[model samples]
Target: MDPTAVGRSGAVILRPMRVDDVAEAERLSALAFAVLEGNSDLTRPPERAAAWQVRTAHLVSRDGAGCWVADADGTMVGFATSLRREGLWILATYAVHPSWQARGIGRALLDAAAHHGRGALRRMVGATTDPKALRRYRSAGLDLHPTMVLEGTVGATAMELPLHVRDGRPSDHEWMDSLDRGLRGAGRGEDHTLLSALHPLRVIDRPHRRGYAYLAPDSTVELLAASDRRTATDLLTDALSGAVGADVRQAHVTAANQWAIDVGMAAGLSLRAQGYLCLAGMKPPSPYLHHRALL
Candidate 1:
């Protein structure tokens, strides 16, 4: 077999990512993002590494074929992990070492990972502000909707949540999965276990009303899915009950989720355009907020 069956020189290769690659992939991913979002340099908290490893491991376990890694010698320099569910294909994570950017490695990994979505009718990914990544998604045939973020101190005013919304329990998993199917064209399934563990899930379930939101301790909406725009707004509003006067943030807002933007701004939070929500064969799901890695 040819050594460079994947690309470049024999020293560099693109191949199926192994489960063991998750550790290296997580490190490289963090370093790359730090560089991308640099205020001047890069740093890591050290303790947060294990959490990402668990998340990355789940992706590999569920869809190994949808994950790929770029290896130069024995080191993992780039990787992409994706998953296909109920006719929807989601790009979970895509990153390349900052030094390897613009070298065609990202394009290769994207093409490889996207193959897993071949028969899926819809595709989605939360993209960053990086120009090259945006171009790659555009070239792949996804329509781009600029992403917005609503962030600031939650005025004491916005913390009021309606009566129907309540703390989600373990029993709510099935219902949340149902909402996932209705809104995003798929069910999160086991992914829910991971998400709920990371951020406690908040829910609203009633006749004619059903929705879910994962709220971090800091009050950011990690993810939200709902039956209607109003339900979606309520769930988001509820996420901020404990964030009053603190510097809070809600991210991953797209034009598809204007209700969130409206509710957020009405609470005195500022809105700004950041990355994008790229889609193919679908429109942005309304009253929905997305998790960067999971969505």
Candidate 2:
């Protein structure tokens, strides 16, 4: 099924996905991800497509799992995926086939995602640094919230640190809680999604646990090193180590604290990309979560 052919008027249809759509979805995914200019920077497009297809297939396979697809003549043109959490839904991905562009297909996908969160007062979305998507998100009633972001292929040291330690377990909620507090002190709001707190459960390296510096379930990588001079490097090592089993062509870091920048530098993670924090509603409070973990 083509992700671009979704949402035709009378003959076309947009509805939840089904089991049979996996192969076409994977195909569309490969075609889509293949457009990246830096496909070889880290992970390749096929790997990401496979992983996304697995996740989407899982969503379509489960009961109460919500995934909306725009189908035209039995072809999947566009699709949106979400996960329900604490009675609210978090959008995972919303995409329309490249061939189906400028036809409101993306909007249809977003609307479907919003529809999945019915009765919930608020919804959260995370967008990457893709400028085109950023514009579309803003037009879709998403507000660009400021955040502490660090990205660049350009290499530079933000700060230096001098502490090293092994990764902490996900079950170590106490330490995580403390780290959260420290992060909050550095100016982060209370937008804690599972992705933000993705730590502990993630295993590092297929052969052993030493492959990743920080391992967590969702996305957060608690620092393994902290110092005035080399904190950024330690954090980068932790993040790269933690990114196993996932396709990451590049790394984007967002942090409000000195430690975040410092560790990023030490790890040699570049400051290559930039983006705005997208908020769903009017301004709320100070110290909002950084952009990288907004979801």
Candidate 3:
């Protein structure tokens, strides 16, 4: 589809994200958050910028059709990226340059995502700490769920179960997809592929059930999917132990999942920050850890 005007005036246009827009999107993302947090940095640090680029590239490459950018006149002012997995639609990232705030750009981009995700029993999810953004999400019909960011040094905890942990392989795609579908209520095939390629995908196999986690480059656990509290805690402990040398490890824990929070605390992780998971449509009843931007 061609880039089309989404604003009331013809000056503002909305279009699919291209490879060239990655850097600006990253900068805008950082700037938007900095402004919301009352920080001085206009752009994120080098490591954060690089990580954001990687995530943006992953989303754009896998689901570019649902990614939209807002341009005011000839300048890019905002963008929104969404990914579809099974019946779930995730608003991976949405940002508007601080200078362009208060305009209808954000709403326009959100409307574009809503339009693209029309069919199916899709549940849309996103995370944000910004009150204005949360208000916008609510205006767009999403209900908010509280969440917390947990971070700390990895503890010396060990699991004595008869489970085996191994690096995920290409041949394990079907098994991983099925496990994800059963736990998350959606099959994130492309997301798993992209994340597995960029990060260390660890699979935990047990007699009763299986679990998985993605170890991000920053030594944080991106996603931890498991059937029950025991499996989830085991996977989390494994991920945390892998970050032994790192100063700290982080994970996004949902307030609804008290067991996960307890596990994180038991593993020596402390509360770092808090946010909300804005969701629309049917909610999934599973224990899973996710990145704030991509949840």
Candidate 4:
């Protein structure tokens, strides 16, 4: 059992996470990820922490019961946050303080959080390449679909970006949700609100093809979903073209989205296999790039 888990063993107690725990949990998550993802090119810790704080607060507000924290005395040592949108349940983030690893705390935290997905029609998460994490998700019965990432300084491209996309507003919610359902099997619901808080929304709404993408401050494609590959490809072109000369990246892109690969290559971004989007009861969605935490 996790000490401080179940409210038990050692000096730690496990309990449902609250909004107040966001700050400390954010610190622990950053520490854990720094060790897990040693990528020298990752966003600076301060920027990453700020983003983590926003997303963590959003998850806690939307799904308090799905979030759990392991308290070692009064300090948060391990935690997990999750979200459910209808039949889709996803692990938002999970972490244990570096000093506290290998003590079964991570497993306990995960088991407590995974309970939130018990009745979902499908479960998925965009996971890092950590082998232990990989094994854990595999043990939970999700098939692993390795994902690729496009990252580097924005370079010149001859790719024709013939399609155009416009900024999206609240009025487009219904249309976006409907497209999400058709492609991803479930509507994004409140996740859009969270994304809106951190980035700008651009949508392609044509009769033959349609799609939406959230452009991050760093020029990364935060999340994108489209009715077809061409529309998605077009959206990427427009998004990247608009961000030339800035560093950019896109992650959680599976082989199903070859258009993304082709576009990234054409834009002069280097591609590499990075992580896995673990899934159960669904195939990889094409022409879509999942949110880092909200897949």
Best by TM-score: 1
TM-score of each: 0.93, 0.60, 0.88, 0.93
Winner of 2 and 3 under lDDT: 3
Error of 3 at 21 (Å): 1.5
* Count of clashes, each model: 0, 38, 0, 6
Relative to the unseen true structure, what is the C-alpha lDDT of residue 122 in candidate 3, on a scale of 0 to 100?
50
Which of the two candidates, 1 or 2, achieves a greater lDDT against the reference? Answer: 1
Tens digit per residue, CA lDDT, model 1, 1-295: 2222445534568888888988888878888888899845454566567768888898899888789899898888899999888798989889998887898899888888888888899999999889999999999999999898888878887356667888888899998888888778888888888887777788899898899998865787889998999898888877776677888878898887889888888678999989999999888887788878778
Q: Per-residue error at 12 for model 2, in Å?
A: 3.0
Model 3 TM-score relative to the real fold: 0.88
| Model 1 residue 135 lDDT score | 90
| Ranking of predictions according to lDDT | 1, 4, 3, 2
Instruction: For residues 1-295, write the lDDT of model 2, one tens digit per residue.
Output: 2323434545457777776776676666455545533353323356545655665665566422457777888788777676553333456566667677566676667666566666544445566555666777777677765334443332333323324434445344334333333432221122222323433432222121121223333233432312222333444544544443343323323333445555444445444444554555333222122222223
lDDT of each: 0.84, 0.47, 0.72, 0.82
lDDT of 4 by residue, 152-266 (tens): 8777758575657898887777888888787667888887887887889989888878899998777668889998888888788878887787788777789899999898888
Global CA lDDT of candidate 2, please?
A: 0.47
Worst ten-residue run, lDDT, model 3?
Answer: 1-10
Alpha-carbon deviation at 95 in model 3, angstroms? 0.5
Q: 1-295, model 3: which lDDT tens digit per residue?
A: 2225454434678888987889888888888888888888777879779877987888788788778888877678889988777677778888888877777778888877666566646555656677778878889788877777777665666423325767778777777678777755577776666677667887777778777788876556787777677777777666666665455656566665676677667667788557776777655345778655555
